[model samples]
Target: MPQEFSRTERVADYLQQELAKLLLHSVRDPRAEFVNITAVDVSRDLRYAKVYYTKLGVESAEAATDVTRVLDKAAGFLRTEVAKGSSLRTVPKLTFKFDESVGRGRHMEDLLGRARASDALRGNEAEADDS
Candidate 1:
């Protein structure tokens, strides 16, 4: 059988976990606060990594930009920190991206809820007509 996960995928998983910890306790920038790493995509050659994150506790467009800037500026430092924990020959260049899926998911849920309410209201009206 082939390997369950390719080298790039394994690296991505490792980066996601280590980056989360580093951002949680190692990074001291206030702008970097509340960063949650949703996923990491490592290039097939392992030369680059794109980290997807979401801001917690008062997320805003401006705040998201600030967090992205801070993370990008600190990419070298984060990479070094990550290197200390892994045996890879070279650490991938880090790139931070604000994960929009979470926000989209919330929006989808809101739309679904409204649809359910509308269906319920229609059901009540039908019952009244039947009485």
Candidate 2:
């Protein structure tokens, strides 16, 4: 019978959980304090993993950069911790990436709101002309 999830998917899920715990309690960098792991993608061979993360309290570009820098620097230590916590033969190399989807979504929402407001104003103007 075919399995629902492949080994790499299972490993990625496990790593995501472990990494969240490590980032929350073990990592002490102030820049990374607000960091939240959003998702993890592991390679099919299990040799590499890309970790997507976002900040909680701050939304500035500089703050995002700082968080990414801190996480990237601590990747080695985090990988070691993962190895110690898991039974995998080889822990995947960690790569930290700032997740921009949240920001993009917010921007899109703002644009949509502006468009709606403009449409409503135009509709009111058309009614005034019709009267």
Q: After superposing candidate 2 on the true structure, give the runs of residues whose Cα lies further than 4 Å from its correct spot.
A: 57-63
Best by TM-score: 1
CA lDDT of each prediction against the hidden true structure = 0.91, 0.88
Number of backbone-clashing residue pairs for each candidate, in the order shown: 0, 0
In candidate 1, how many clashes are counted?
Answer: 0
- Go through the candidates in order and give the C-alpha RMSD of each one to the true structure: 1.4, 1.9
Prediction 2 TM-score vs. true = 0.87
Give the per-residue lDDT of model 2 (tens digit) for 31-121.
7886778889999888999998888865555567877888889999999999998789999999988888888888899999999999999
Tell me the tens digit of each residue's lDDT in model 1 across 14-57: 99999999999999998888889999999989999999999886
Clashing pairs in 2: none
Best by lDDT: 1
